[model samples]
Target: MQVQKFGIEALDNMLGGGLRSGRPYIISGNSGTGKTVLALRFLYEGLKMGEKCLYIATDKPPHSTITSISDSFGWDLLSLNVMDAVPTPSLYSTVYPVRDVTAKGEIREISEMSKNVEKGELTMESIILKLELEYKEKFYHRVVVDSFTTLKRFGVEEERRNPVMAKFFRFFVEKGSTVVLTVEGNIQKIRPELILSSGAIHLKREVQDMEEKRKIAVLKMRGSFFDPIEREFIIDKNGISIRKVKSK
Candidate 1:
């Protein structure tokens, strides 16, 4: 099976080269565990490989968040396609002119996109429709949803979240796009996405000796052998760098 790099070298090594390609994966962790950073790194790595990438910003405004990371890491996120489904008005646009799709689908002209910008907020269904359009146009190789938690709560009702999520995963699979969805919650508590996805990477933060420590573990990866240890990692200006494991 083919594999995709997670961008972090140690993580790539841990997963025995990289994650299996064209499968859905979740990054589960509590807040401040570097979930968004990790997801961005995944997309950044794909960008480096000249692959078309998409980022569906659901938590904060896509522009500010991407700009912050781009400036911090010296990455050109402007080149990447970003879908701004954020509830609030987005500050700026991305490479794809018709971002912030509050309307339904088929946003061809700038005037049309602007006309429907205030019609209604995008629902999960609308987002899926927009994704279908983007896939047809861009054929994105990698996709990242900053936090599925918000998307689920705001985009869909509780009764229909599961089915909607299932559809979300299926869309990526059918399109042959590797997806990384970030979710906020305890890693011990198994989430529905964890079960639906092909694999999961859990990020954990603990305070030890009056200092905070971050650890990442590959909970499960299908069709790949991985080092299932919780290795330490640090986030700096350049991005996440995992501690190298020593051979005994």
Candidate 2:
């Protein structure tokens, strides 16, 4: 199967080249485990490849995240496309909402505005449509939806998230684009149905001998081989650096 570099060399090597193209992958991890940072690198690499990329910010402002990326990687993100999906403070009581800005520091054109959003219009399906429209219009090859689990409460019930999530993943694959979703929580806490139909990568951090150690593993991939060992990783001023585990 064809693949694209995951942008992290050690990770690419572990996954036997890189992520398979046009596939939906879930990156699962606990808070502060570098899930966001890895996602940033994924998009940053796509930018380097000259591929149009999109970042759907669900947990934080796109501009602030962009600034963090720029400050850390020295990569200016004023040209990347971003959708800030958080509802406005005043309008949280209603479905009406607005976005932050694009990489160029301009407001994004949302299909549904604060005044036009109807009652019970805050469904993941509806929000996805607006984003889907952008992907279709601009033909983004790489897309990331940060902490999609954040909105699992909006309109979809607990029992229905799987199918909705299944559709969400398929939507991108069907378009021949690879989409990455960051699931909030560790492997033990995730529902079995959530990973039933798509690829998954797990991240973890633990204290060892008075030092903090971070690790990553490929829990599942549809039709590819991924390194089985949990590799050690670190995040410094330069960004994430991965290394092979050594016997104690």
Model 2 per-residue lDDT tens digits across residues 1-248: 77867677888877778888888777889998988888878888888888877788777766667777688878655556766665442212112122222322223333343335554335567666665555545677888888777755556777987778677777787888887888889777776524653577789989989998898987877777777788888888878789976889
Please report the TM-score between candidate 2 and the true structure: 0.84
In candidate 1, residue 20 scores what lDDT? 81
Give all candidates' CA lDDT scores.
0.79, 0.71
Q: For residues 50-116, what per-residue lDDT tens digits would candidate 1 score against the true structure?
A: 9888888888887788878888988766567777777665565544343443333564422233434
Q: With candidate 1 superimposed using the best TM-score fit, by how many Å does residue 81's alpha carbon deviate from the native?
A: 0.6
Task: Name the lDDT of candidate 2.
Answer: 0.71
Model 2: residue 212 alpha-carbon error in angstroms: 1.4
